[model samples]
Target chain A: MKTQPLVIAGRTFASRLFTGTGKFSSSALMEEALLASGSELVTVALKRVNVADADDDILRHLGHPQFSLLPNTSGVRTAKEAVFAAQLAREALETNWLKLEIHPDPKYLLPDPVETLRAAEELVKLGFVVLPYVHADPVLCKRLEEAGVAAVMPLGAPIGSNKGLLTREFLEIIIGQSRVPVVVDAGLGAPRTPPPPSKWAPTRCW
Target chain B: MSFRPIFESHPWDDVKASIYAKTGADVERALAAPRRTLDDFRALISPAAAPYLEQMAQLSQQRTRQRFGHTVQLYVPLYLSNECQNICTYCGFSLDNKIARRTLSSVEMLAEAAVLKGWGYEHVLLVTGEANQTVGVDYLEKALRTLRPHFAHLSMEVQPLDQEDYERLIPEGLNTVLVYQETYHQDDYKKHHPKGKKSNFHYRLDTPDRLGRAGIHKMGLGVLIGLEDWRTDCFYAALHLDYLERTYWQTKYSLSFPRLRPAEGMLQPKVEMSDRELVQLICAYRLLSDEVELSLSTRENPTFRDHVVQLGITSLSAGSKTNPGGYAVAPESLEQFEISDERSPAAIAAMLRRQGLEPVWKDWDATLTALAR
Candidate 1:
């Protein structure tokens, strides 16, 4: 079955199965897993990688031509910190695409809606492709889209929680009315659990 | 609001009475409740819950595996100093003990770090007694700077400081801070900590608030078991945890249960916590909150530690020395407490592997603090 390709920030993605580089026991294992997933777009936490070294353990494994590194501001707590981290990530990874995540709360890693919106607007003005991680709030998703986010990565549940699709109703609402891409991020857990199909297009997950 | 107000509202005697008054019905209700509350926690830890230990253990093991998987994080404690101004009744490092006190120098600190690094320990907890003039913020900052490059995660178990002090240390790559309220009993707290800065019970009670305000990445809180009534003390600890989680929504939290062990010139435990009771407490904590991290140290015997690992423990420290420079620099230095589980890290890791649990050496990275500047 040939699925429709998803386009975000003017870049074409052949695979909608985006992956993340975290919690793997080793970089080699992470590389193998990401490769097996056949994900073209992989998100790497800027806080987890050594950006100064080109051959950093985690970075060295992510050099495949098919992989587009989406450096995320995972540790930043405020809008200013997110902007600073994004700039550093851009210079180090040499890509303007970012997963804007300003989560001050570490327990659940829930995104700060205020900080995400503020950072998204500033990041977009700075000529970066901002994909903000946020809650499954329909109004907040619309607000992020209005603020010029390339896509809104609304969480299915708390990050890393294996409980699947706790926020299905809100996700459906966001997917129904979203103008930009709606990538369901976090809490999808299993590989076989597919993202909900949208009426207009297929929803993405990372 | 700080936890001070909440702590003040819940009188110790009343809470203890309520926990003791819980009936079997309350315990059953708490066990059956889908979402356990603090009240449910009372029933779960009460004497009535003793009969349901097996069921509680099963649920706890399932919940722990569901959340943390079949993995246990490994860490070792590097005792940096035993110098103290406080006269803690249960500690060998108490000022009045008259033992030879030692504080690890920068050279000595790295030597200890080298030994732990050789053991494949990426997480190290630096322990010290409360002595302001010698082992203050300046000394701690230098220690972090010296040891940060060697370890992936660094935690401190030292004297409580103001919020500003934690703010300074966090930028220096300090990941977690463990400040245990020895006991929540006010008069007994004063009795145990008779002298020095630690005698300030309210100040110590509010230390977590300072850490949270300082934007610490993680903070650990617990009450020393066998201090007063273990049940009441732990209830207060849980209440404090609940308040901190709501207030410091940004910071991560961990809980520890340190049963008093034999130490030189130390007083006997006021209340003894049986191994079975401790197991009940661990399982009750898991049922209460699945998100919080639970840790057990080397104070327990190997058999107890091994058995409880399956119950609810998320992290464990093996091959720990509770004295200054006991690792490599000054092995002859006086230890603050006697450790029971003296198994090497490799041996412990092997044991974990045998039990179908993976031993995780490095779960955090130093690069997380790269943007602190």
Candidate 2:
């Protein structure tokens, strides 16, 4: 049977790959990669965009009808800051959607699950469609799902380490129990290969 | 969400002292038994377990090999920024330290990621400091975006954020967040973190609670060694881990022993844990919870790291840089702390091979992230 589109918080995503506008050699290359990956929901960090300017480089390049922008509160370290960033993103990008990531440690770039949960609870109450970045704990996935999260993004490994899922058992648990959707975030695929575990590492296993 | 009792409150010191007072017979019971409990772990970690160290080693080695197989999950940290507002005494990037501050622009993050990718890494850690205004959530999101396209999976290590923040990041293709309680000793923690948001020891102490409520996928926990009595802090960490595992049954947990290292204007660690003690802790973690991950970093010397892998460590970091763009951008910039085992990824891989263990490089998928969207 063919896979169906993933619907989250009332929005339907035709493609599963959530492309980012950050890494390509150029925006054109990023666009090419995004198209090739067949991703519909694209995530962009609110930091890179010049929200005050109507014309922003990355934002303009990401302007496509088929794609949805997921402005993430990646920089804010507190729930309060994330709430403010989310409000700003909602106003500037004209969308009540956000990706919440709060981490205090800079060395390993680890996420703070405590603050993330707090934010998810409040954001859901605030009417903003929230997606959270967390570990591969299955129960947490369920809780976020219960908290009305669009999806649960659990790491295959540490972010940008390209380490791929070190927490395999946990990821499996999260995947098995997730209700909304289980997106294997961070540390799965190779930057260059992007396909095989040895070459690219992203398994479309979902 | 009804659950079993989290844990019966025991003064962490008492538990440590009890662990310290374990006799060889206790270690024998701990080793000879089919199933072990927290008490058994105490026996195994106690000083009296010394004469039986060789015996403990054999058991730990066998248990580890059996559970983990002959493999090691390898990862590298891409330091994206070093700006901070928190005044953590033992940290390299503590706000009080007058060091150079750097935050990677979207492009710089990619440049740094390219280096990690070149090392055959599939999982990446997007690391940064706690400068809310500059390298805040938006900055992290952008970094993940910049990285998500290139990497299969993404993980981050930065400042803690609210639950909604984590929830939101989930949609953006960001995953696991690891937060270590430098010390569970609230008063000592306050002394270490004298200013900034991090100074709120209660908020930091209650972080896992928030993570549980937010429903994060997995949360890694640890207490920085040298900040407090390792045993007591670890007991609290174990207690917290037990509670977290039970309370947030769905979330996974991992532990790291981040010993205080000499950094730019960083304070000296109060108690230096010997390599022997660290091994005991790792083995104890395994004995206590067979499933929990024990990660060893490059902070330790090559010799010590080489030995501990055989003891219980499931995850290892090979070539790591602690400063932003340390991998590629500003190679000579002030590192968060000096790394001891400066081995290349290949060297670490070779080392694992020599020990009859395979080095695991990739763990997540870009297609999965894409597929989830």
Clashing pairs in 1: none
Best by lDDT: 1
By DockQ, the best candidate is 1
What TM-score does each of the candidates earn? 0.88, 0.63
Top TM-score hit: 1
Candidate 1 lDDT tens digits, B6-61 = 99999999999999999999999998998899999999999999999999999999
* Candidate 2, CAPRI quality class derived from DockQ: incorrect
Q: What is the lDDT of residue A98 in candidate 2?
A: 84
A142-181 in candidate 1: lDDT tens per residue? 9999999999999988776677789988988888888899
lDDT of 2 at B50: 67
Model 2 Cα lDDT, one tens digit per residue, A67-128? 78898876555666677777778988998878877654432346777878888998989999
Deviation from native of the Cα of residue B257 in model 1, angstroms: 0.3
lDDT by residue (B1-373, candidate 2, tens digit) is: 2211232356556776787788888888888787787677777767787677666666777666655556687888888889999988888899988888998898888788888888878777777888899888888778877788776567778888887777667657775678888887767888999999988876676777777677665578898999888877887787788778767755667888888889888788999898888887887787776567788888999999988888888889989999987888899999998999999999999898787776766544343333221
